[model samples]
Target: MIFDCLLTADAAWLGGRELAGPTAIGVREGEIGWIGPLPAAPDATHREHIEGVLLPGLIDYHVHAALIQPEKLLAAGVTTVMDLGWAPAEIWPLVERARHDPGLPRIHAAGPFLTAPGGYPSRQPWAPPLVAIEVDDPAAARRAVEALVAHRPATIKITLNSQAGPVVDDATLHAIVRAADAHGIPVTAHTQGSGQTRRAQLAGVRVLAHTPWTEILDDRLIADLARDTTIISTIDIHGWGEPSPDREIALQNLRRFHSAGGVVRYGTDLGNGPLPLGVNTREIAALTEAGLSPTEVLDAITGAPLRPGAPADVSVVPGDPIANPAVLGQAGAVLKGGQNVTDSDGGG
Candidate 1:
């Protein structure tokens, strides 16, 4: 059968974890229909031979999708983004738009942060009043979760930033986790301050929006966290464009966490600082410094495998990213749902 598009690469990163040499992939009906050796089909409607590495498009585990244009992400090889926090009224529309538009990165969002009264982001200048839901008690936490669940958030985001202000009490934190669990939704916490990481783990938070940077985590706690929670690496945000104590602490903690078999995913906290629109190389370098091997680093960003029946989202870069992570920032070609969003020259 004839396919809609065919992409052949000198080497393909299968699931971003292993390499397959001289591979070809066929796209049909917006899904990968075939993957094998080069020249699998000579009569496909469209075909392109990539003189580089082909891999699944990147997934940024944390970002504010509403604050940036999706096309920027698409151009940079990100095909999906998990938006950690935003106003539901404003973000849901972007998610819906992304779902229907193949040219945009798919957006999964957690609307409004659940925090204590007058807590963290509510007082931050960049965060508007509506960006945080203030909960003072278990009942309030339940109500807040219920309200957010109505919007069908991809996950629940809770602020445990005791350094900034009064944080959600343990009772309230537990309530939020329980409520989210009842709805089959995972909870992600922005853990900060001493012991906050341990608190989040105890409360059954499934993910940390950012790797805890304020304190060095003990090995025992790191092991425990590794057993269940997945940490999104927003280490570069601590430094912005320069190194700082926070960056140092984050790198140390992450190194220990990874050594103990912790799960780490790439996330830049894009809208919070001077982060790039997509594929922050600084974040990649930070993860490398934190002891992640090249393969692990690639797997962190390419969250899912490219297999038959998966969405036809792929990134073609001119060099082996495993050899040089910085090459990831330069996409030779990008495809979303079987359609070419950018060509080998990095132009749409």
Candidate 2:
């Protein structure tokens, strides 16, 4: 069958390794139909020659859309972003837009912040109305989870920020987790201050929205978390480029977390501060500092490989991304589900 588009790259990243290519990737019916060397490539209606490397679409595992525009993300080569907290009413339209528009990065949204009454973001001046669904007890927590499940989020987000305000009680936190689990949904938390990480861990949270930064985590807890939980690396949120004690503590904590084999996904708490909206080089630098090898770094920021039948989601990043980490922040071309969304000038 003649595919809709054929992409030939200088090289390609597949299965955690970079293969020297004249790699040919075919897209048809909004999915990848074939991947092989050019010598064995299938016929296509059109060919897009990539003078750069082809890699799976990058994913920023944590972001909040309240302050940033979605179009910028696609241009930055980020084809997907997980928005951890937003008012479902405020965020759902954007998520729906992304689903139908290749020009926007797909959003895997975690509906809203489920927190204690008057907790955290609700008190932050910048939070939109109803950005959180606050609960005071186990029963209330379950109901909030039920409400969120109806919206069909990628995961449920709970805020347990002792440093910011009153946190969800253990019973309530457990109820939220149990309720979400019953429906096959995982819980991701924004944990802060002492013991909140452990509380979330003990309550069966599956993902942490940010690496813990308020204090250094104990080794035993880090090891235990590594066995089951994944951490979203938002290390640059502390100060971006400036020095801060919080940044130092978070770096040390993440260093140990990595040593203990904790899974990390690249995330910049975009919109929270003056973070670079997409493909944050600062965040990548911090990840490298935390000891992630280039391949692992690529894996953390990108989705699965270009296997046949996968969504035709990929990007052309300039230069050898593994050799020159800075190139990962820029895109020459980007395709989301087989539709070229890169700028007309080929700037992603």
Q: Rate the local accuracy (lDDT) of all candidates.
A: 0.87, 0.87
Q: Model 1 misses residue 259 by how many Å?
A: 0.3
Question: Candidate 1 has what TM-score?
Answer: 0.94
TM-score for candidate 2, please give it: 0.96
Model 1 lDDT-worst window of ten:
339-348
Question: Model 2: residues >4 Å from true position, as ranges?
Answer: 343-348
TM-scores of all models? 0.94, 0.96
The alpha-carbon deviation from the true structure for residue 90 of candidate 1, after best TM-score superposition, in angstroms, is 1.6
Model 1: lDDT to the true structure:
0.87
Pairs in steric clash, model 1: none
**Candidate 2 weakest ten by summed lDDT:** 339-348
